[model samples]
Target: MSSYLLILLLYVFDQAFGESQLKLVTVLYRHGDRSPVRAYPTDPYQESAWPQGFGQLTQEGMRQHFELGQFLRKRYTGFLSEPYTRYEIAVRSTDFDRTLMSAESNLAGLYPPNGTQVFYPGLNWQPIPIHTVPQDEERLLSFPLSNCPNYIRLMNETEKTAIFLNMTKTYGDFLEMVRNKTGLESTSIESIWSIHDTLFCEEKHGMTPPDWVTPEVMSTLQLLKNFGFQIMFGVYKREEKSRLQGGLLLDQIIRNFSAAASVNPSGPLKMIMYSAHDTTIVALQEALHVFNGVQPPYASCHIFELHQDNESFSVEMFYRNDSSVAEPYPLTLPGCAQRCPLQDFIRLTRSVIPTDWDKECTVNTHSSDTDVIIGLAVCGCVLLLLVMLLFIVLCRQSEPSIGYSHVINQSDDHS
Candidate 1:
C-alpha cells in the first residue's frame, strides 16, 4: 500500500511541475551594425559615403556579435561535447557581405579554436561554415520582399490600416515641422533610412555634416528613422504576416528535431545556430506570439529548448539580449507550445508554411466572369498566325529576286 501511494505521489508531482530534459538548441539572431543601405535627398551621407563606404559592418558591430558568440560558447560549454565537435553545431548567415562578415567575426569569438590543444601559437580560431543564399533568393532570411507584387499591394493596403494611416499623417506633419524649422525639404521614409548612414559615415571619414544639422537634431532624426522601421515592419499587419512566414521555417526546423528526438535520445543535431537579421528574430517571436514592439537589437538571439518527458515532449523559449549574461528571459510559445505533446508541436507548425504570394497574385479574379481560357487560346492562335505572316514578309524582303527562278530550275532538274 505504501509503495502504491509513493508511486502515485511521484506521478502527480511530475505532471504538475513539468520536468523537461533539454538536449539541443537552435538560435537565430540578426547581423551587427551596418552602414546605411542608401542615401536620402537631404541626407548627410552621400555617394562618397564613409571611409569604408556604404552597406558594410562597423567595428562596433563586430565587437557586438563577437561578444554574442562568446556568450553562446560559455553558456553551452557543459551541454556541448568537449573540443567543440563540428558536427554538433551548424551556423548559417544571409549572403550579404555585412552579414557574412559578421558571422565570421562572431565565429571567432564563439569557437576560439585554440587555447591549450594546439601546435601553433596566437591562433584561436576554427573555420565554421556559414551557409547563405543570394539576397534575391533570400525569402527565408528577409520577410516579404517589397519587390513582390502581391506584397507591394498588401503594403499599400497596410498603409490604409487605421494604425498605419494615423502614423503617416503624424509623420507627415512632423516632417513638415522639421522642414519649417531646419529649412530642409528632405525628410521621408526614403530619407530617414539614410540618416544613420550619414552620421556613421561623416564621423568615420572626418567630414562635417551641413550646418543645418546639429548633433541633437541628428539624434532625433535617427530615433524617428528607427521608429519608422518599427512601424513599417512591426505595427503593420501585412508586413508582420510576411515576417511570420519566415519564422514559420524556424518552427519547422524545431519540430523536425523534436520528431527526431522522439525516436532517439542522442542521435544527431545536438545544437544549431542561425546567424541572421534582426527581422528574423522579430518575425519568429511574433509567430510564437511573443513579439516586442522594438526590432530585436543586433546579435539578439531567440533560443528554442525542446524537452521530452515519459508521458510527452515539450518546448520552452528563452531570449538573450547580452551574450555575456548567463540568465535569459523565459518566453512562452502560444497555442500548443505552452505545454504540448511532441506530435502536437509538429502538427501545429505545419499549418504555418506561408502561402506563396506570387501564386496568390497570379490568380485571375476576372476568370469566373468570362471564358477567359478559351479567349486566351483564340487570342494566342491569332497572335501566332500574325507572327508567322510577319516572319515570311521579313524573309522575302531579305531574299534576292532570283529565288523563284532557282526553285523552278531545281524542280525541273528533279523531274
Candidate 2:
C-alpha cells in the first residue's frame, strides 16, 4: 500500500512540475527616440538643426534602450546566462544608425563587464555582435519594401476604395491648409505627418513650437497621422498586405520557435532580438490581428515566449508599450487561447505567411508580358535570318551566264 502511494505521489509531482518549461524567447522592439526623418519645406527646423542631422538616434534613445536591456536581464534572470555568451543570444538590427546603436546600447545593460570578460577596469561595456544586411537588400525588418510591385498595386487599389475616397474628400480642406502653411506644392495624409513629426520631436526635445501650430492644428495633424498608419497597414485588404509585409517576420519567428521546441535538452539560442522601427512592430501586430491601430511608441517591445509542457509546445505573446508599467500587457492571438498551442498557432497564421515573397510581389501580367515579348523577339530573329539566306541564294542564281562564262575562261587560261 505504501509503495502504491509513493508511485501516485511521484506521478502527481511530475505532472505538476515537468509539464511546462520555457524553450525559447524572441523579442522585436522599436528603436528608441530619434530625430525626425525629415523636416517639411516650411518648417523652421532644417537638416542643420539636429546635432547629428536627421534620422539619427539621440542620447536619450541610448539610455532608453539600456534600461530596456536591464529589464530583459531581470525578466530572464535564470533563463539567460548572467555573463554574455555568444552562442546563447543573437541580435539583429535594421541597417540604420539608430537601430545599430540601440542594439549596442541595449547590450551594454544586458551584459555589463564581469570577471575575466572585462577588458578594461573603468569601462562597464564590452563588445557584442549585432548582425545586419544593407538597407536596399534587407527584407526581414524594412517597412513598405520598395521591391514589391504587387503591394504597390494594392496601394493603388486601396486609394480607389470608397472608404479611402471618402476620407480624402473629408480631409481635402485640411490638406490644402497644410500645403499652404508649409509652402509645399502638394500635401497628402501621409506627407502631412512629417509636419506633425517634426513638431512632436521638437516639443519632446524642449524646443518651442511655431506660433501657427495651434492646439487645434496639432490635433488635426495627429488624426491624419493615425490615418496614414491605417492606410499603410489596416484600411483595405489588410490580411493580404500583411502576408507581404509583417508576415515575413512572423514566418521567421515561428520557424525559430519550432526549431527550439525540437531541440533536445535546450537550444543553443536562448534569445533572439530584433532592433527595428515602429512600422515594423505595427506590421507584425496587424498580421497577428492584435494591433490596437495606434502607432507603437518609441522603445515599444513585442515579445514571443515559447513554452513546452508535457512534450507539447505552446506560444505566448506580450507587449510592453510604456516603460512606467511594471509588467507588459498580455496579448492573445485571435481564435486561440492566450497560451496558444504551437501547431494551432502555426495553422492560424499560415494564411498570412507567404511561400515565395519575390514571386508573390511580382505582378502576374508583367511576368507573362515579358515572356511574350521574349518569344516574339526569338521568332522575329529566326525569320530575319531565313530571309537573308533566301536573298543570298536568289542573288547567286540571278548572276546568270556572264558569271559562268567568266569562270570558264579563267580556268582555260590557267590550264
Candidate 3:
C-alpha cells in the first residue's frame, strides 16, 4: 500500500513539473474588435455611419492588437529575435479587412524597425508580409466553413434535439419580438446573435443602443450568441462536428509541429502566428476539448508550445484572455498531463482528426436514385404494354410468335 501511494505521488508530480526548452510556438488569436459586419434593416446606425465602413478595424482595435503583440514580445523575450526575420516566424490571416489590419498592427508592435534594417530614419515600423488566401479558398484559419453540406445536415439534426428545442421554446416570444423590431423576416437563437453583436459593437464604440436593446435584452442575446457557438462546435454531437470543422485546423497545426521539428537549425521556423475571428479560437479549442463555453474576447489568443528536453518532445497549451494577468493560464489536455508527450498528444487527438474530409462531407446522395426508379417504372409500363399487345396478337398466332422471338434474344441466341 505504501509503495502504491508513492507511485501515485511520483506520477502526479511528473505530470505537473516538467517545463523544458521550447522548440516551437504557435499563436492563434481573434482579430481585435471592429464594427459590426452590417446592421439590421431597422438599425439607425447603418454602414454609412462608420467612417471606414462596416467590418473595418477601429482605432481601439488597433491598440488592442498592438498591446497584445507587445505582450507577446515581452513574454517571448529571449526566445524570439529582437528583430523580425521571415525564417523565424510565419504570419497568416483570413482574408478580411479587419483581420489583415489586425495582423499588420500586431506585427508593428511585435517587430518595430531598428538597427541597419530600418528603411527610413523616421519610420519605426517595417513591412512584414502577412499571408492570406481568399475567403472561399481559406480552410486552415476560417471557422464554421460552409462547403460541407453534411455539416449543415448535422446542424439541422442537432437543432431537433431536446436541448435546442427547449431553447427555442423558451425564447420563441423573445425571438418574435426581436424579429418585429429589427424588421427581419425571421429570427432564431442563431440569427439573433447578429442583433446582439450590432448592439454590443455600438456600445463598445460609445454609442447608445436604442431603447429596445435593454440590458436584459443584451444579456439574453449574449446567451443565445454563446449557445450558437456551442451549436456550431459543441452543444451536441460535438466530436462529430469537430471532425467536420475544427479538425481540419487541428490537423494543420499538428503537421506544423512536424515541419518545425524537421527544419534546419540554421534557418528555423520557430513560430506560426494566425490572426482570425473569435469563431476560429472556439473551433480549435473545441477540437482540443478545451473550450471554455463562451465567446473568446477580442484579441484573445491560444498558444501551442512544443517543448524539448534532450531527445523527447512534449506539448503545452496556454490561453490568454485577460489583459490584467501577467501570464497566460496553462491548459492541460484531457487524459494527458500539463506537459503532454508529443506521441500521446497525437494519439489522444486522433479520434477527432478526419481521414477524408471531402468524403465525410459527401452525403449519401445517390445521384442515380431517381433515374433508377424512373427507369424501373418505365420498364414495368413497357412490359405491361407488351403483355397487352401479346394478347391482341395471339389471334394472329404465327406472326406474333415470330415477332416475340425477334424481341427475345434468349430464344434467338442462347449464348
Total clashing pairs for each candidate: 1, 1, 0
Judged by whole-model lDDT over C-alpha atoms, candidate 3 comes out at: 0.89
Model 2 scores what on Cα lDDT? 0.90
Predicted candidate 1 versus true structure: per-residue lDDT over 1-415, tens digit per residue: 9999999999999877666666678777777877666655666456675556677787877888888777777877777765656777777777887788888887777777655644467666767788888888876667545555544555566667786566567678666656665446666653564555556456654667677567776776766766655544455663345433554555556655655576555466667777777667666665555776554766677887667675566666788876556687777655654555666655555544455545544324466336777888899999999999999999989987864463357767889
Q: Write the per-residue lDDT of candidate 3 for residues 1-415, one digit (tens) a residue.
A: 9999999999887766654688899999999989999899999999988999999999999999999999989989989999998889999999999999999999999999889879998998999999999999998889898899888988999999999999999999999999999999999987877898899999988887888988999999999999998889887888888998999999988888766555344357778999999999998999999999899998999999998865677899999998888999999989999989988998989988999999888765575577788899999999999999999788676553443343567855866
Q: What TM-score would each prediction reach against the true structure?
A: 0.72, 0.86, 0.86
- Residue ranges of candidate 2 with Cα displaced over 4 Å: 1-18, 263-267, 365-415
Deviation in Å, model 1, residue 193 alpha carbon: 3.4
| Candidate 2 lDDT by residue in tens digits, 1-415 | 9999999999999989777888889999999899999988878888898999999999999999999999999999998999999999999999999999999999998999899999999899999999999998889998877689888988888889998898789989988988898888999876777888888898899888878888999898988888788778778998889988999999999989988877454457899999999889988998899998788888899999999897699999999999999999999999999999999999999989999998888878777899999999999999999999999999988875753353357767888
- Model 1 superposed RMSD (Cα): 9.8
Error of 3 at 45 (Å): 0.5
Better of 1 and 3 by lDDT: 3
Name the 10 consecutive residues with the lowest summed lDDT in model 3: 398-407
Candidate 1 weakest ten by summed lDDT: 238-247
lDDT-superior candidate, 1 or 2: 2
Error of 1 at 399 (Å): 44
